[model samples]
Target: MTEALEIRNLHVAIEDNEILKGVDLVVKQGEIHALMGPNGTGKSTLAKALLGHPDYEITAGEILFKGENIIEMDVDERARLGMFLAFQYPVAIPGVSVANFLRTAINAHRKAADPEDKGISIPDFRTLLKAKMDLLEMDHQFAGRYLNEGFSGGEKKRAEILQLATLEPAIAILDETDSGLDIDALRIVADGVNSLAGPDLGVLIITHYQRILNYIKPDFVHIMLDGRVAESGGPDLAEHLEEHGYNWLREKQSKATAG
Candidate 1:
């Protein structure tokens, strides 16, 4: 399997305190990889670093997106390179309609794909937007609403997926996309992700619960401990983590150190 994202000994820090110590993760094309862990274990930090968040600094190591070093790339540059990150908390932008935001994003994507004067026309844009919205079961009225303003948690997540569908990114980092969602919303989001899954798209779903795994099974499950990925395996690993919790891992680590 060809690699979509490759991280080599990634060391990240925030305010001089290291959060990710020599972590490595790789996602191949068309694969769903889940990064599961307890709260505050650097899962979110890793996602932030991948998206080039300003506060998180990469103290060492390299992030290769399709063999290109992306650590130094700015957030917009990363997005332009077909990398999308759906935030855990979708921010609200008043006075910006969903329609306008989506159209602008789509235009940006088109511009990145073709740097020439060519771009997706307005009519073609609307058609594509409508088609994706329909796939996500989003209301036509949603187009007129301010971007995520007054939206429920479920609505925000659906909107995120809607953007994902429209952007068709090569690598999608869904950061805790399932948090605060009910069963119905979870199903809808999962369905949206599954429908869009293919050889061209690789997903890294950062989640804490196993419920979402039922809807979209990951090809690989990685457990992030204190500052690094401690374990990795297939889908069954998620089930194990759900049942036994992280205590066993803590115990094992302690014993290994003592011995």
Candidate 2:
């Protein structure tokens, strides 16, 4: 069966403040879904909850991945199950080299998948890393640098992309990957994402603006309003949002609530 990530009536909260009121969505492998909304609408909260962040508690509902419930799983467990979240602001690991960080991660994944596995050999890892880097058109020297340490905004995002590539997760939640990027940087990052899109991955891109969507066309667009999904449509929805802001949707929502 094709791997899928399903969120049904997912209610998430941070401390006492509930953020995601009731979110329901499904992303299957080979699909690109965009979750768009203004600030404080719970887009990022949903991403965190999906990945089992301890602070963002899942008060209710179910999260199913590949036909298995993941609500009770730990963060690393969820990652091992082929779920990944690219943060809006990636933190720098000063002392860890990019290659070393990724190698460690891959080894962990290997150990999880099989207890008998000793992990990939260094020569084999280098070969795999080089292949992935070549596919992303990155220089070998880039791997020797510290992970995200003293890197530019574009380079930071690039490192995330490289992580995504190496991990090869079935479902990826990109939380505002377009933030802090200039036009050129955004294009390069989007190009990297576009190249990696295929039947093997299901991508959920969470963002507040349409600037990045112009480059990475989404198969589905969802709009969040006041902690719930108020609307869902094709790529035209994103275009409509760009053309005319969320006021119209807000008006419609108000009407529905009044009735």
Per-prediction TM-score = 0.97, 0.97
Per-residue error (Å), model 2, residue 164: 0.3
Show the lowest summed lDDT stretch of 10 residues, model 1: 112-121
Over 4 Å off in model 1, which ranges?
Answer: 1-3
Ten contiguous residues minimizing lDDT sum, candidate 2: 131-140
- Predicted model with the maximum lDDT: 2
Q: How many residue pairs clash in each candidate?
A: 0, 0
Predictions in order: lDDT: 0.92, 0.93
Q: Model 1 reaches what TM-score against the true structure?
A: 0.97
Question: Candidate 2, overall lDDT?
Answer: 0.93
Error of 1 at 62 (Å): 0.4
Question: What residue runs in model 2 are displaced by over 4 Å at the alpha carbon?
Answer: none
Model 1 lDDT tens row, 42-154: 99999999999999999999999977999989999899888899999999999999888888887787787777847678788788888988998888888889988999999
